[model samples]
Target: MTNKKIAVVISSIFIFIMVISCSTSNDNPSETPVIPAVLNTVGLIRNDAGALNDGYVLFAPIGSNTTYLIDKCGKQVKTWASSYKPGQSCYLLSDGSLLRPGNTNNTTFNAGGKGGIIEKIDWNGNVTWSYTISDALQCQHHDVKALPNGNILVIAWESKTNTEAIAQGRNPNLVPTTVWSEQIIEIKPTGTSGGTIVWEWHLWDHLVQDFDASKANFNTVASSSKLININYNASATNQDWIHLNSIDYNASLDQILVSSHSFNEVWIIDHSTTTAQAKSHAGGNSGNGGDLLYRWGNSLAYNTGTTTQLFGQHNAYWIESGFPFENQIMIFNNGNGRTGGNYSTIEIIKPPVSGYNYTQTLPYLPATTSWNYNYGNPNSLYAQNISGAQQLSNGNVLFCNGPAGIFTEINSSGTTVWQYINPVSTSGVLKQGVTAAQNSVFRSTFYPKTYSGFTGHTLISGSTIEDVNLISTSCK
Candidate 1:
């Protein structure tokens, strides 16, 4: 689908997609989509990329529980809606399947949160394999990456001996009320007994300071004998409060790169290529520390925070297998509310040499730092300052003005070549003259070098796609 055609389809959906009426608010079903999946597009399109020749876009639309798969031109292709609230790490496999982490909370999860499930979805949206951590302690905030040998690597939060710690009287000093262990595990599909764990890592054995105590959000840490930390506890574990949101393994470097969103840094686990996970097994004891190595995002000799490392972003890691910069780290800098520097941006940076390296020679899509926002009053559903950015093969950028549900395509020089808007609303909330309409985007993501599909058929392909082919036999 061409950008123009995609725009028309989005407009049509907006024109017919009914808005909920307030008169029926009381009678409205309790299950209105909390993550409504309406979508749109933005930015200049691309064509052939050096290494990233073709790929799809993956995103969590508002309302829907599934992870959507759209074609190169913004055409709805497939979906993996396995959980109510899908986690941040979802990788599209080479076979067109998807790998994602999910969880279920004992108490009520937020309106859109639910059970946890590590899943492998086939192209037909079928669950080829699934593992649900027992109901006692739920695993949230996880990341997954597929290895060359078909094994999957994961970074997750595991229920620690905290309850056991309190029972044993060995709780660390100044620990938050909520405590849990952050972990990394590798799963290999064994034709018969599901996937087997090949390697694993944890956050406990490596901490030397009161890191979790600094994270002070989310009750993942604890000071009481309570089985778990208060849901209000700021940091969960890792005194640094390392909220590991995304993980990527570089086979070339035999290294594991983790995006610790909350802690404001990335962690690298370096293992020599000569011994790339040679003798590793998952689900091992946390006391052993030889099987792993570590480096801080900005403190190491090679990482100098050159491009201003991300602050609270989601899914920052290597591109897909066939992507142009397959090994480079591309981040969806969600710009989740606060950035000491620029308001929001999507950054694609080359991996650092060792640690403590820095550079600004990367491509950046900057959000409109200042944009007025007034719902209804002539500007209802008005654009806000929040924005999204993705890197294309040819160095152009795909930018999403998240606040107003607006998306635009830009060239390498920062030009809007294409655009889109999301119009998702609640079931019974009418918007006559309000100041914050219910239709917009929480976030967006594009496939490496490929035009990640958008809602309906609003595509943001590269400038190479001069015109979108909406009526092509491609959809048939």
Candidate 2:
């Protein structure tokens, strides 16, 4: 009832409330900062018992003008120079010639993944042949593969008009500019800088649409759901619907395996058909012509949405026929938006084939992957884009976690035997002390020491990244 008594009581209540608030804050202290996955060094991290494939690693940076062939120790054995920035893919031929895609200035098609040129240079760094594929209608982009008969298989974007896409049942409001579908073209190089189209396959011809009954490809997805949906990237008009990233040829089966990154599937098409026959569904050795002989990964794209298989995967290909895990399909399963979190996985599946078509149930399909590599910790090992995996001869797998700039090899039992961080850094990737982002490689492929591609060329000894000495003649 006194003034002093009232003031003391108010002071006590204020102090008690402040103390409880501070305790609650302490109890929920900010979570520990999670370390990101990045690599800043080059050379061996752990060469447990040595490398499985004793040879060279060939890779080109995403924004560079040079491609290097380096030994297992990361020593550059050879180099190929070009006038254009490197594309996402490159390769070396058995005759010591290099095949690579290069970027060119573009003003026509406003899209991503722009590589307008492809060049072939000999081991001596001479431009043997070059060809330009970028145009108003389409442009070469991500990947390329050299065929056995001296032709190159290139992936490009074929433009679709706004009116045309809307006619195909795409939402007009969702279309910003125009739609770009994917295409595969086989080009035979001619004099110096020209090529002739020997064979081609377009995705536009093999699409399925159910949104419009009056459209050319109209059909209920539930009735006949084999073609790709025409309305995938419904938001951005400049977006690519079917971004095809990697391409591989199966010589024994005369088929082609292509990775459609945007759609999350790998398509196998017969390469044994004539150019005219490839436009239809009835002519190749498999009797399917340009139609997909086999398709696997995401069924939701085809309307069989029971279970999702791949999450924006990349680089799906068949293992080399004679390798230890030969004939099995492999993928750089960039497990984005997965149940747990973002982590990359290597999925190898022996497709159940009964003749030409894939053999599997409608909803459950294939049932399981033959083998895979997700290394318990998926978050730290995730690379959402631009990566690959290869099954080696000694039953080991070599893969590039592109985003982290790390290349690793693991045995059949999921044990890491060899590891290397890319030491070479691109223009903006150089950090003060961190080695996690020194450099990034889209893919790194291994070559045997005795591979005929290196037969006569003398490999030099120097730093992991060195200048080439092309004084000697090439293997050819």
Candidate 3:
């Protein structure tokens, strides 16, 4: 009851309360830091549990001439320098070389995804071999695939004059001044900088159009689904008609898959055909020569379906053997004009194959996607163009929201486990806390540590591409 006794009791209660409060704060820290209204941090953003850590990501910034290989922690492992910026895909080859398309700035075939040269550079930055496909009449662009036999498959724009287009049954009213048709050329590398075109397939050769009955290639549009309808998306001013943005080769079946951006379709053609046979409707293993053996996405392109499944999509390719969903195609559905509202999704479809040929169906088989991923909030993943997705060995999906220069990896359950933002912009490396801009990446590819390309090379990890500060110390 004394004054001293009362003071001691009050002091003990105060100390006990303070101790409990400190313990609670220390035990239950915030699960995730509050993100800024505008994200300014670059490089590795997240590397949560469940991410495939035994891999490196390879990416070519659209604004830079350098291709980078970085670890999951955002440490640079290696880089390949080029004289020209990416035209815009790059790949690390099994023999410790970089294969990339360079934007030689071809004025004649000036369009998106324009690449006039393909270069193979050794790990030590030596240009081992280079091939030029740029010219007035035709120019290589977009993607290329290295064949198992040391050859290359290239996608190019083959120009056709208005007269030439109309002669092939293109509607006169829709014919452009110059129609940039597409072609796939298989190049046999003879020596450094020298390549022989051993085989080529032209889109012009397998055309069918209902616009002009008098034309030699005229046929019912829906019935001749095997052939490209020359008038489907023809425009009076848009010369880049069949804008094929990606090319993938399936070695087992000897077929090539190409994504037609303008048509909103993914098509497969027989690669086993000879040049002569490819120019006709008969001769390849499928007995259809270079005619499209399988086509999907927008069945409306062939007048077979009412709903269009893909909108301005990109990076359509077959899931490689030995990986989950092998042989199925995975696409970055860009969702440019998606009906419900623009949103992006990584989609996979199992094409019904019957020994090198797709099942004969009105709108192609596998009517819906077997698997697809979008952020719980779909809009969070939207990218209007130039994005890509791939299934990693651990069943995680790696993708790039190209326009945002953001790369994300999600596990099989659609949970984000890893993420990174490209730090190099058109002006070079950005500083942390500086809003990332002009740093778009066409795509980012995941190469497992066991990749043959990393063999015999010492991969020394270096600092992140961007300048870091205290705010990003946790990432370090």
User: Against the true structure, whose TM-score is highest?
Assistant: 3
Clashes of each: 73, 6, 0
- Scored by lDDT, model 1 comes in at 0.45
Q: Per-residue CA lDDT of candidate 2, range 95-183, in tens? A: 98888888886667545457899998999999989888878888898789998898999999888888878887776677757788788
What is the number of residue pairs that collide in model 1? 73
Q: How far off is residue 208 in model 1, in Å?
A: 0.6
Which lDDT tens digits does candidate 3 get at residues 148-167? 99899999999999999989
Pairwise lDDT winner, candidates 1 and 2: 2
For model 3 the local lDDT of residue 360 reads 81
Model 2: residues with Cα > 4 Å off, grouped in runs: 1-40, 109-112, 236-238, 375-379, 428-438, 466-476
Q: Write the per-residue lDDT of candidate 1 for residues 1-476, one digit (tens) a residue.
A: 99999999998877554333211222332322221122112211222222222555565533435665544434455556675445444667666667776655434222122325667777666778876543434354445677888887766565544553344223355354445556667777765327676666555433321234444222222211111122222333433244566677777656677766655455555433222232332121221122333332322112222443444655555655564555566655554434242344555555445332222222211212111111122312222323445566665555555455455555654444444333233332222223324434444556643332222333343321112221121210
Error of 1 at 442 (Å): 7.6
Model 3 pairs in collision:
none
Using lDDT as the measure, the top candidate is 3
